[model samples]
Target chain A: MKVDIVVDARYKSCPGPLLALAEAVMKASPGQIIMLLATDPGAPRDIREWALNVGHKVLNIEKADETYQIYLEVSS
Target chain B: MSKISIIVASEKLDKLLPAATLATTAAVMGWESEMFFTFWGLLALKRDYEPKEVSSDYKVYEDYLRRAVSSGAMPSWLEILEQGKKTGRLKVYACSATMSFLGVKTEDLVEYVDGVVGAASFLSKAKDSDINLFIS
Candidate 1:
C-alpha cells in the first residue's frame, strides 16, 4: 500500500514503460516499493517477464481507465 | 544467464526499430544481448547518422511510425539502443566486411560499438546464445 517511488511512463509504447521501470529499480534500495503508471497495454506482462528474469517482485497491478498502476518490490 | 544474439542487416527505420527493441528488451531483462551490424545495418552505426525512413515496402505506414516517435508514444530506435547499452548487458559490434566495402573506418562508427568483427568471429560468439535472430 505504501509506495516509495513513482515512475510515470504513460502513453509510451512497448519498451519505454519497461525501460523506465528498470531504470528506477536500479536506483532504488532493496524492499522499496515502486509504482509504475503506464498506458501501454503490454506493460503489465512486460514488467512481469522482466521481473521474473531480473529477480524483482511484482506486488500488484491495477487498471484504472486506460492506465495501469503496477506496484513492484525491488529485490536485493 | 540467458543470451541473445542478433544479426542486423538493414539501415531502414522499420528494420532498426524492431532489432533495437528486441536487443534492448533482452538487455533490460538482464539477459546478455549482442548485435552484429552487417551490410546496410552497419550504416546505421555511423556517427550522427539517423534513420529517416522506413523500408520502401512499408511506405504507407511510414507516417504512422514517425508519428509514434514524434508524439512520444514510442522511443526512437537509437534511444532504445542506448538504454540497453547503459545496462552493461548489451554489446554492439560492427561488421568488418561491411566496413571494408563501405570504406567505413573505426572512427566513423558511434562510440558504443564494441568491435569490428567478421562472420566467423560473430558466429563464434553467438553459437552459445540461447536465442539467435537475423533481422533485415
Candidate 2:
C-alpha cells in the first residue's frame, strides 16, 4: 500500500534507519503507513523485531537495487 | 515498548562499544533503555574522557583498530550513546560508589548521564527490564 511518510535511510548504518522510523512513527497518526528505505544488512531483522516489540504492523520489506524498503502501518 | 538495562563494568573500548551500540538499537526500537556505568566503565562517561587506549587489549591488531576508529570509519562508543539519547528513550547513570571513589561529581559527567545510582537502585531498574545485559 502507498504510505504517507517515506524515510530515506539508504546509505545509513544500523540503528540509524530504525531511529528515523521511530521518530516518524511518533509523529504519524494512527492508520497511516510509513516506509523506511535502508541499506544496512541488519535493517530487515531490526525492523521486524522493532515492529513486533512496539506493536506496529509490518506490511512487507522489499528489496530494490541493494537497498530495502520496509513498510509498516501505524496501529491505532 | 520494551525495556533494556545494561550494566557496563569495563574500561576497554571493545567492551564498551557494544553496550552503547545495543542501547542505541534499543532506543531506536522505541524501547526504554537504562545504562549503568560502573567501575572502569565510568571512565568513558567522564566529561573529559578520551579514547587514547584504543587496541590496548587487542595488541596484535592495535594499529589496524586505531586506524579504523581514528579515521572516522567507526564512531566512538560515546558518540553512539549520544545518538541514542536523542530518541529520549535512553538514560545513562554513573555508579554512585564509583563516583565517590573517583571524586567525580554530577557536573563532571557528560550531559547524557541522568544521575548517579547505587547498585540497589540499578538492580531495581534492571529487574523490570525485558532485556538485562552486563557488558565488561
Which has the greatest lDDT?
1
Best candidate, TM-score-wise? 1
Write out the backbone clash pairs for model 2: none
Model 1 CA lDDT for position A25: 92
Best candidate according to DockQ = 1
For each candidate, what TM-score against the reference? 0.98, 0.80
Q: After superposition, how far is residue A12 of candidate 2 from its true place, in Å?
A: 2.6
Off by over 4 Å in 2: B48-55, B59-79, B86-88
* Candidate 1: tens digits of C-alpha lDDT, residues B1-136: 8999999999999999999999999999989999999999999999999888999889999999999999988999989999999999999999999999999999999999999999999999999999999998
Error of 1 at B31 (Å): 0.7
Show the lowest summed lDDT stretch of 10 residues, model 2 chain B. B65-74
What range of 10 consecutive residues in model 2 chain A has the weakest lDDT sum? A11-20
Docking class of 1: high
